[model samples]
Target: MKEFTFELPTKIYFGTNMTEDVLQKESAQFAGNVLIVTSGRSLITYGYLPKLISIIEHLPGNEKVVVYDKITQNPKLKEAQEAISLGKKEHVQSVVGFGGGSSIDAAKAVAAGIASDENIETFLLNGREPDGNVLPIIAIPTTAGTGSELSKGAILSSPAHHIKAGIRGKKLLPRMAVIDTSYTWTVPERITCETGFDVLAHAVESYVAVKSNAFSEMFSEKAIRIVGENLPKLIRNPGDHAAREQMCFASMIMGSNLANIGTCLPHRIQYAIGACTESSHAAGLIALYPSWIRHEFEVNPRKLNHVFQWLGYDPVNDAAQAEQLFSELKTEWKIPYSLSELGIRESMIEDLADQVTGNLANDRLSEKESIIRSILKESYLFRQ
Candidate 1:
């Protein structure tokens, strides 16, 4: 086994109704002012937001709770700035991320900005590091994807610059993470399917990542198996509580895997696609998976075979067969398989490839521009 080190600083509370229990106990450490960052009114419409507020308001030393519900999908840097302004104005001493990955990512940026009192764009766009003055964060995931609650990275988009990227730091990890499976019970079928695909992507990419070690692969393999066995059950019967629990667990562990080893080409490419198009993050990844799998099969067949076996497929020596199996899985889940389906034009492929940023060290392929353009073209015209 290769030498490696791992650490997870976030205190996790996971269960059916562990949300109230965790918040009730943890909120005591919060200051007089708190900020709740969310995507929209879904939490309120579903009563989760109100319940969270009630719990915090009744806790000692929590005199005020502010809600910032303007977060959107693929959260923008400006959104984080706005949220930070709100948090600073309200004197928020702590932050709560109360929804999906987008909400949680925005919350982390807000927390960093509020405490550092600096433009978070420097951290997101440039290579500036946080000064370790970030406010404490509590993460409550409403969906079983992204795993932002347990991650030390925050993905934010800059609309003006036409870039979407991540800010990573140990200080960004939440002080507490509440993983209540009940929150995912109300997720729409499409969202559940897409988010489940996100879990699968995270595991597959991390398992093959150049930085992966024995310890991270342990979590990656288990998460892949769990998502494969449970995602389809949840899709067929959305009321499968057992499957829901398994997926939720899988998502959290995958988050830890992501934090430790990180992802490869698919995630990096998707950031560019997200910056250019209105495609959902999971949709872009699903579209790119066939090409990514084919690449892995060529350069790292042994690792790809492990992933195939965990997904219940017989060992295959052929790259085409490996790609086909993944294609079939997405088809079964009713996900789109081509970038064209997500509004990518043939002319836009080069620009998309050029926009891709961040480390590609985990990918086996050389980070040549021609190679990236070819991959984008293949994903765009795949099966068209």
Candidate 2:
């Protein structure tokens, strides 16, 4: 049992009606105006945003709610800075993240930038550390993936630099996380598959990361089991609220687990892919995870076996069984099986490979460019 230190300061409100039941009460924790960071039109179209706004406006004080919906897929550093600038101008004292991982992460970055004079660009590229002076953030996860609600790392992309990195510190952790399964009930089937895979990636990668300890491993194991059992069900029947609830819990657990232990090759590589091709983060992971497991299974057979067993597969000699499992899941879930299908050109392989940092800190994996290139090649095309 390796030594570890852990603390989760975020207050979590789980189950149904959490948002409408406690949004104003929780928002009252911080005085002054509040900023709501949201992404895309899904939540807005679903009317979640208006309902949230109504709750905030009904608060006791003259607390104004400002909505910033400029967040995009693979959230950009400039966007976060823009949000921070808006928050500062509005005299915002707190933030509410009201959508998926991108929205929540952008909100956290905005929170961090509000606390410091250093811009978000400086923090992403120059290795600046946050001073824990961030405005309070309340995360409401509308998606059952990325686990951004419970995580302390806010992933941001700098398009000019073509880099996707995270600002990780205890300060980025949400002051409150509201997990309501009702928010995820309307997620489309394809998105369910994509984000569902992300949930599994966090569980598996964090469990096998070099920094993993007894506490994180326990959470990771449970998260993996929950996802393995429930994701497929939810994918098959989007109306399964019970399965959706389980997935929401698993996603939260994985988020907390990743915050503590970090992730391995698949996640590290997916960042590079997302930066290069602007592809879906979960899609890239789905394309690469099996190949990665096959490549590293021999180096850490015990860990791989544990994962396989938990997922109801038996890999006697290698990751063949694991690969087969995901392949079947991909076909059943109708997810694209190759990067090319996701619009990543094969010609950009070297560009993608060059961006790979292999900074997973895994003893079984190397950060070497040659090794990363090899993994990319294997993952470029789907093998039947």
Candidate 3:
């Protein structure tokens, strides 16, 4: 086994009504102001946000809370900076990331911005390291994908640079994470399917990354198995409480794996696609994964075989079975399987390849620009 080190400091509170218990216990450390960052009407429409506010309102001492609901689908650097400015203005001593990955990512940026003097722009665009003054964050994930609650990395896009970037540091990890499976019960079927795909992608990519170690792969293997067994069941019967809990468990493990070992070519390509198109993150991943598997299967077919078996497929002699499974999953989920269908054209392929080749490192996939271009083109035209 290769030598490796792992540490996850995010305290997790899990169960049906653990949200209130977790928040009450964790918020006591910050006696001053707190900022809640979220997006959309779902949390509010469902009364989760109001419930959280009620909990905060009753906290002992003069604990003030503010809400910033301006986060969008994929977080932008400008918006993160804006949220950080608000946190600073409110004099918030800590932050609560109260939605999906975007809101959580934005909250992390806000936490770093509020605690240090460095410009948020530099951190987003130039990859500047934080000064370790970040405010403590409490993560509450309404969606079971992205696993932002337990991750030390925050993904943000800059329109000016036309790229999606990540800021990573130990300080960026949330102080605590609260997982209540009930919060994910209301996720729409389509979103449920797509986000489930995201969980699988994180597991697969991290498991196969060159930087992966025994510790990361242990979590990745368990997460991969959990998502494989439970995702389709959850999609078929959205009311399966056991499946929901299993997926949440898988997502949490995958988040820790991703932070520890990082992801491979597929995730890097997905980020590049996000920079150019309005495609959902999981959709982009679904569209690209088959090609990625085809390219890498020759390097290590046993790894691919293990993944196929984990996903409940019979042992395959060739990579074609994996591609076929990919198509079947896409059709079953009603996800678009072509980049052209998602408005990413042939013209954008070169730039996408360049962006991905520049940012991501992988031992299996060739980093040659021509090979990367070919992979992107195949992913674009892969209708089957």
Candidate 4:
């Protein structure tokens, strides 16, 4: 047993209708103004905006709330700054992150940015902590994945820098996180699959990260198992609400696990792919994981074996299970089986590898490049 510390600071409000609960319970803490940040028409068309107005209609004077809806697929620093400028202009005292990871991440930047007129790029580049208390942020997650509700780190991309960076600290954690599984009821089936993959990736990478401890791995192990069992079921039968609910729970757990234990090679590689290809983060991860396993299995069999068992693969002579898990990711999940299948160029592999090596993540960078490059090659050449 190794030394470990455990702390979960976010106030989680979870139920079939917890979104409404959060609006009711936490809305009054802020001043007259509120900024609701969201993405896309579906969430808006699906009642997010209407319900929000209803919530504010009940506020003392029934003042209309301010909202910024310009969040993009993968949040960029410029958009986040734009959202912040809008929030400041509205005199918003509260911020609501009302969609997936991108929206929530944008909301985080908005929350901190609303506190100052200082340049947003300074915060993005310097990691300058927001001074004084920030506007209260409530994360209303519509997706079962990303679990940005529970995480303090907000991933924002800087196109000028062409990299993704996290503004991470306990203070940035949302004051309230409302998890309503019902919001996920209408998520596109493809999003359901891809986001669930994100959950699985978070669990697997965090489970094997060097910083992982028993406390975090306990959550990661259960998260890995539930995701392994339920993701395929949900994909095969998209209307299965029970499975979606389980995946939702597992996603939150895995998100917290990642916050504590951090992530490893697969995430490092996935970042570069996302930066290069402008594809879905989960999609990028699926493209690379098989290769990641192939490259790391020899050196990290114990970790692979544990993930295999969590994934419900028995008969694990560790090495065999490593190969078996890769097969499951390919055959069972039916994820984009290769980087090239997703339109990523073969030439992108080595450059992505170099970007990953220079990435300032939790792991050491010096000796990690070869393993990353080999994984990238494996992803390019992997077969069904």
Clashes of each: 0, 0, 0, 0
**Each model's TM-score?**
0.97, 0.95, 0.96, 0.92
Estimate, for each residue in 1-384, the C-alpha lDDT of model 4 and write its tens digit: 999876678888777766656666665654477788888568778876778667766766435577778887778888888888888888888888888988987888889888866876787677666665667888888898787888877777887887766777676788878888888888887788889888888887777666778888888888888888888888788888888889889888876876677777777677677665567778877777776665556666777788877888763564545655675776666665578876778877777777763233554322565667776787785565
Off by over 4 Å in 2: 367-369
lDDT of 1 by residue, 75-163 (tens): 88988999999999999999999899999988998999999856899898785668769999999899998988889888888889898
Candidate 3 lDDT tens digits, 1-384: 988888889988878768777666765755688889899589999999999878887787536888899888778888888888888898998898998888998889889988888788888777776867899898889888888889988888887889987887889999988888889999998888888888988888887777888888778778878888898798789999889889888888888886787777777777888887777778888888787777677676887788888887787777677677777768876675688877798988887777973336654666544666776898887566
- For lDDT, the strongest prediction is 1
Order of all candidates by lDDT, from best down to worst?
1, 2, 3, 4
For candidate 3, the per-residue lDDT at 32 reads 87
- Model 1 has an lDDT value of 0.88
Cα RMSD to the true fold for all candidates:
1.3, 1.7, 1.6, 2.4
Model 3 segments more than 4 A misplaced: 357-359, 367-369
